[model samples]
Target chain A: MTETQGLHIAVVGATGAVGQQMISTLEQRNLPIKKIIFLSSARSAGTKLTFKGEEIEVQEAKPESFEGIDIALFSAGGSVSKELAPEAVKRGAIVVDNTSAFRMDENVPLVVPEVNEADLKQHNGIIANPNCSTIQMVVALEPIRETYGLSKIVVSTYQAVSGAGAAAINELKEQARDLLDDKEIEPKILPVKGDEKHYQIAFNVIPQIDKFQDNGYTFEEMKMINETKKIMHMNDLPVAATCVRLPVVTGHSESVYIEVEKEGVSAHQIKDLMKTAPGVVLEDEPKQQIYPTPASSVGKNDVFVGRIRKDLDEDRGFHLWVVSDNLLKGAAWNSVQIAESLLKLGLVTVK
Target chain B: MTETQGLHIAVVGATGAVGQQMISTLEQRNLPIKKIIFLSSARSAGTKLTFKGEEIEVQEAKPESFEGIDIALFSAGGSVSKELAPEAVKRGAIVVDNTSAFRMDENVPLVVPEVNEADLKQHNGIIANPNCSTIQMVVALEPIRETYGLSKIVVSTYQAVSGAGAAAINELKEQARDLLDDKEIEPKILPVKGDEKHYQIAFNVIPQIDKFQDNGYTFEEMKMINETKKIMHMNDLPVAATCVRLPVVTGHSESVYIEVEKEGVSAHQIKDLMKTAPGVVLEDEPKQQIYPTPASSVGKNDVFVGRIRKDLDEDRGFHLWVVSDNLLKGAAWNSVQIAESLLKLGLVTVK
Candidate 1:
């Protein structure tokens, strides 16, 4: 192994939203670390953070910051990842990048650990995490694919505000207060902050989740469609996604309609299969009014599946209600799981 | 037209949540009502209400309350409607019932004036308002159905917390506050309050809108399926719904996937049809990331339709997004529109 009992792990963009969560997930899971380096943008370099009960100074996350680091995790932004991820890898540290910069890169392994753990073995220093919505969908759909071959996937997501980062979550809260007090407020940092206009997400549903792609589908929808095929190793898999933003803080719930290749499979059997799946907690009981929700799923790492049922006409088709803390299973947890997989596989030793 | 200028209008259960909206809608729309009679349960009888800058007293609803009333509106619970709507009709007052009690009854015409204004002439004293989800969908789909025959319909709704009534709305607010403030909160009024357990709606999606029926579809889903056919005058049309309650306050948004009988229909054609449809506002412009949002739709009577696209490889399949203020178009506005139609049709005559 790289080190006897500790590995020097540098967290790139450690002060940003998902960056902070990645740090927390690492510490909470009690990973073996010799040194925890907090790296942020140049403007945030003077900041301090408490890691494992000790105050650590944040450094600017440039290519040079990867020097002497074992594994560097990137979650700052797409531009930040595009610029610095390869630099960290060139410095002999494996990079688990959370941004979408390299996810669709043919050579890079877009890993969800549960779906493609073996995909990590061939990674050339950089491992890409799928989009938050795509991550949760693959976790729920992987077991099904293994048992019954998957043919088609149609998912409608009830995505959370935090997926847009910390600013959008704050916007949801502020707008809700302004609405309650009957005060006039303008929306900011939602449906896409860089887009022309923003919409209020406190008590609304935003049909657009990301920038509109050329095919009239939002970038988020295209991510799910593209990433699902890649993760399942089915380049010809039929996938359609309607990514919608809801007024939730943490958890992302999805209504997924999937068609399995096998015939005559019951919803009960699907429910049974998901009940014992890895990183899954089945909470479906329609009679007792029990199902998974974002509020209840906050702060948890498990991808929750509920409301399982077979489509009435299509005997091979089934519907699934999947939910998970978008920040956890969607981002930090999956990233951390990749790091954990790296450790166990001895693919990247901090030597 | 039944002595047009000002007529006596009676509102049953005038002290409840929806009743207040009904009262405000009547005043906001400037309906021609000379005198307004407010009726409620015994416990709410003595309550005072302000309408058009005047305070009216709410009296206990009785059969005699319909006497001398040109038209009566019912928003009391379904049981109260089942017992008292006939009584109001026996007293010669045309009842525009907002409860589910008579929506599916063969004798009662469930009407959304924009969709089935002609159905008003066939009503037998009791005119029923479709469910909140149903009303919005029919308003969006009715224009398309007229131009092209509809064969099969499937819908998955991201409903608001307000659809369960004001208490559920309050619960959502309270729980949101508690969750943001980091306090443990108990949910008591969601996913069917009368059912065994309650779930927090802040970050969750509860698939069961109403109680589960014997056929595995929840009552809310059945309402959409049955009520859509009844409103469209299509008895054998196939329809299915999966209604989910998201933590939104005012508007209900739905992801509707449908297969039409006509082949090679373009999304642009559907957009053109929706533009001229009554009570329909087209908010679709995917290039600039513009579409219908629930927060922007509150306090309006229009049903917002967007995200019109043809499913790839399925020439006859199309996907649409539908949204509306449930309290307005779903309940209050539809009820008031029905009342206005009754006055115009001479179905309600002053004694």
Candidate 2:
């Protein structure tokens, strides 16, 4: 290939929030792309998006849209991925699916690049991007898990409304205005839009993110639990998650309680380990009153961690506060990073 | 003394946030107070606030402000309470301090009436209100602690900007607007105003609420840790807190991981117990997509509990998602409740 003769790239669901970020991430990273195909539903087919100073008209994504595409990034709904991902792969594209569609499939490789990029080699023609919360988490913890044998993890998240979609972010803004104006506020798009009930997100938190499974854990929480095990290569890693939606627009913060196999480990030691870990930013300085905040983390790709302290009772337990821009490190950036990895490792050849 | 006689009252630092709430709370609850003496700093003297539709002028608070006052509610800064609580006490007014100035004092009684009302009998003229997070957590967990037997608690808080003060709330709003408008966002009045630097609370979760102590716990986290024990009357109870500020304006939500002293209790059993708990509303049905949201709990006084689940690995451990309006149950209503307890228990009488 010539110096700038790049791979042909296609982005499924290019009109959505995460899909837009995926397109931007690809542009910002400059991952050797020669041609770009933007796909959305038929309703959004004529939508125009500018990347690298060129206005690209989005096309209606059908199975035929994947023809000659070297790499396809699918971020439509899960159902869309369920139908379109295989078609893209069959048409000679290596698909990086961003939906929950291929995530739990035993054959599809789930990649964080920083955590489990090697899993990409095992991809059955399609790769899975883990949930936003799980992707940021395992990125921070996997390094520590390798150095210090792991036991258990319990995490409660402070997530931004943007994770739900642009509509939810708009809803939070609308409701906050109504709340402050002493006007009646109503809910239309939170907890789960498909679920029967909805709650306002303004000045509040909703505990349920995705719908609840039979196990009582919301689908969002179970995604964290199962996805963490898969990404960390530890199905028996004793993980628990409480996923919550806050009024933030981007970024996700997590209070993680961890039990390592090693005993008598001080919080400072773990923090030091995180300081050197890849894709992690350690901001734990108690004396100067330094720590991470989601607002400060917006648009940043690194996972910011602080508030590390040993558990008061459990000698083997430790606690950490993890924060990151959910759209960046959690989704779009992770996908871009995986594409970079695929290129760097010479795992994919342009047809 | 006749039962219908109005009771004399003093409102210390009446111009502040919680103090303003105290005034409105009394009006809302229709407490029959004979008089309200509005006291504040010398700078705030001559200000007027309407109470019960009457224009009450604030006067500079001095040692004599408590003279002939029956019940004094203080929400001034801690220094004011430190210099003036005893002065108010010596002048015969019963002081309900909303500052940490007197909390944890061996001679003073820290009371959350629902959790430990009888302790009011030992009060030496000062009843300390618990921290906002602690008050809400104890309100939700105290009943569970009583029925299930308490052992350990791990809480992660999604706090409101109002908890920092009215100025912080304004800062959060303005910063959000600036971010949306692509203007330069200034950071002030957040992550501890007294610290050397400030961070924006818009679209952010700052882990540090107060200045960090030597112990690495932000004063806010330490407050949740320490106040929870004193309120629940369990000094040895293992409690850890990760206090974070979201862009919220009023309510706070906590993800509480608790280990019960008893074993083999299902999540359903705990949900059943909390559904009937006093001062609590259980909104924990996952099937119908019903769960507590912070926006829904804003104007209410009761703590809302939901997202109850037993930890998959630890039969003794369970998770609870608790939410309450910090300005209400966490502060104003809680303070007002203490005053009502004093009046009902015949602990306060006009001179």
TM-score of each: 0.93, 0.94
Sorted into a CAPRI-style docking class, model 2 comes out as medium
Tens digits of per-residue lDDT, candidate 1, A1-351, equal 222768889888888788888988987886688877888888999799987788889998888888878788889898998898889889888999998999999999999998899999989889999999999999999999999889978788889889999899889988877766678889878989999988878777889888988767789989998999999999988787888998877788888888899998888889898988999999987776678888778899999998887776667878888999998999988998999999989986644
DockQ of each: 0.52, 0.61
Reference-based lDDT, residue A31, model 1 = 66
Which residue pairs show collisions in model 2? Answer: A295-B204, B7-B34
Winning candidate number (TM-score)? 2
Report the C-alpha lDDT of model 2 over A1-351, residue by residue, as the tens digit. 222578888898899999989988887785887788999999999999987888999999999999989889888889999888998889988998888998999999999998888888887789998999998888788877988889999999988888888899889878776666678977998877888888877766788888899988988999999999988888888888999888788889899998899888888889889989999999888787677878778888899998888887678888898889888888888888888888888887644
TM-score of chain B of 2: 0.97
- In model 2, state the lDDT of residue B117: 84
* DockQ, candidate 1, vs. native dimer: 0.52
Off by over 4 Å in 2: A1-6, A50-55, A176-186, B1-6, B30-32, B349-351
